[model samples]
Target: MTRPQHFGWFLARGFGPQGWGYPSLDWDYDWTRPEVYQEAARTLEQAGFDLVIIEDSPSLGSPETIDLRVRHAFGGPKHDPLLLAPYLFQATRHLGVVPTVNPAASLPYTSARQFATLHHLSGHRLGLNVVTDTGSARHFSDAPQLGHDEAYDRAEEWLDGIRSLWHSWDDGALVADRATDVYADGSRLRPVAHRGRHYAFDGPLNALPFTDGEPAIVSPGGSGRGLGFAGANSDVQLALAPLHEKSVRDYRARVHEAAVAKGRRPEDITILFAIQPVITSSSEEADRIVAASARPDDAALQQIARKQSSDLETDLTALDLDRPLDLSIFGAHVSRGSIQRLIGDRGEDAPLRAHLTALARAGRLSDRTGFVGTADEFADLVEELGDWGNDGVLLWGDFHPVTLHRTLDELVPILRRRGLLRREYADGGLQANLRSF
Candidate 1:
């Protein structure tokens, strides 16, 4: 029997109000309130998505100065996803809440305790997206920001410490029996004396054992270091859905090979590509919608510039948008992955200035790839990906409530009818749902 494809949503605008595709999103609406996100989580539960990955960053930059950050509200003023997870869990039963955690910023012992607590409370409907802080390391503390490889190396030790703490209290340690006047089996509990290059933890976690087993682990980075870590550790790996067939095959194969080398079956780790679907009632209508959404105006273009500058960690406001950009100046600060996707093979000796200028002019605020079509056509795309052995997709376009409802109400049913998506959730929480595929 063919396994049903797993589905998840990458909630890009956790609580942000401004983003592409949603023009009518209320700017004054309070993002701190639970109702804003709870409604979306409940909708996903109805859609039968396996999980919702919430992204966060402590170092939201002010690239073009305070005005840019305040004007765009791009990545700042963010609420803690941990505090918001409970609301989502309370709003829905099966939709797993996976929040990104930067190990460099949060201690492993604290992460373990918090995740374990959520696991117990949510019946194992929890996942942690381990992230090595890429933003300024100074923001995390006084510690210098380690290089990319070093960050992952430290993350490896951090994860080991967390696992040790989690296992400190063995199974069946909690025996609430009044007859013996004892609650926990003291002998079964042990302490984790973990001291590593980056972190040190001495003793057992001051928390109950995780209920319904360990919460699912998700790894999203695609760097070489990230691939190795994900292959060895993550239950699910989040990646960008490629635009070409060869890219898809190569990416999946590489990750599977990594898993195999690590003594893990390829099936043990599920890979979900990030996608956004532009759904409409008909092909022509979809095309018309796409056309309408295209060609953003001057104000929007400026916002895009601000956002790109923030990501590149350099202010491009003063640079001539039309002149050939001196690529040497950007240096290593430019994200290599972003460059590959945007420039592709056309970047060989090409002037880099036009690329950045083009991005701003085109109003390409985000790199999130999407399919614009009728529901049936979108289903075909999903089926094609599954046929290529891709596990599933993670959807997110805008933070607008309408987009979430339309995806759940219109696109989901089409996918279910075509047998490309699960019609109902599995018997347990997020982990069970992920394993069900």
Candidate 2:
């Protein structure tokens, strides 16, 4: 098989909003500016990217303020992202539309139908980002909380139910069999029944599928109970890790382990580490954009990385980095599950305080791993990643979810010269471009 080019794009107008190739959120100004957002979408479509996913979240536990030390960039769509998919997909061609949906937060039966409908409308250009939220149970909206384990258990059964529904009707299930006087083929349609502790449902999906199979499923990332859900059902691996090579390798390896632990083919799961992109004519120019005492933090260097504050921000800065981190400070912002992994990854001498400081010093923490060099260097980096082990990268940039304004001027041209990245997009959706290669 021809080696695949390994790179994709991610956008959450809330976090690293400006790094993408389009207009980012202006929390103080106008994120509601539809025309501005539309223009940005056009820019990305013209760039020949693989996909543009809309990220969503309902809570804002922390303030959107940035100190010189650190910030939480979480800017997102003010409206329902699902409603916007067909519009975004239609406004431009070849850009796949990925919409992040917390499985537990929404009803699967309804989602199954909506996604099936989306698949039809987009001509099979839709992809799903399945995020199983572990923070709080959504059993009750105004509802009660389901235990974490129970929630995962629900996801397992729910995923099975949805898949069965998606695949229920075969091609041409809607037959105009005049002789039989039947509008549809009853024998071809089947109902799926799945029973579990939290929920149970069974039925043939109400709609016919446009895609041959389920829209390529992407695991939005989770741990403990969540990993099992991802391994069994996901096709793409999603994560936010430090940009350093070691961090990328570690996440890819962990996700691969999850895939292998189950009976699933590990190759079916592609590891995608998120990076807030920072492109420039030269590496120095990129640095200049964020003029800071330290490396202008990736998203922190921008205005929005501060949509929420992790508890470690202030305390870690206050404590002596020379000392060490006290994991106890995570009482509210995080749980112990977030600690053991950090300790194991960083080693005993490396204290939690140091880790927090490092993250603050480098805002490129989540999705921090991306093209940081001149166009030529970045193009080579993308090529190198394919040689290494990455399936592709999910890129963002500071202040905006776009990385293009600089990329088009600096990187794309170089990539084209090298015959690596495309100079002109082929006529079709993002998948047609990807699968052909």
On lDDT, the candidate that comes out on top is 1
lDDT of each: 0.73, 0.58
The ten-residue window of minimal lDDT in model 2 covers 304-313
What's the distance in Å from true for residue 221, model 1?
Answer: 1.8
Stretches > 4 Å off in candidate 2 = 1-4, 14-30, 62-77, 136-139, 142-150, 170-172, 177-182, 222-227, 241-254, 260-263, 283-292, 295-325, 329-357, 360-371, 398-403, 423-434
Cα lDDT of model 1 by residue, 298-355, tens digit: 5555556667655555565665654544555553434566546444455635444445
Clashing pairs in model 1? 325-353
TM-score each candidate: 0.90, 0.76
* lDDT at residue 218 of model 2 (Cα atoms): 72
Per-residue error (Å), model 2, residue 9: 1.7
Q: How accurate is candidate 1 locally (lDDT)?
A: 0.73
What local lDDT score does residue 103 receive in model 2, on the 0 to 100 scale?
64
Mind giving the per-residue lDDT tens digits that candidate 2 earns over 5-58?
535666555322333333333333244434444555677666666676766554
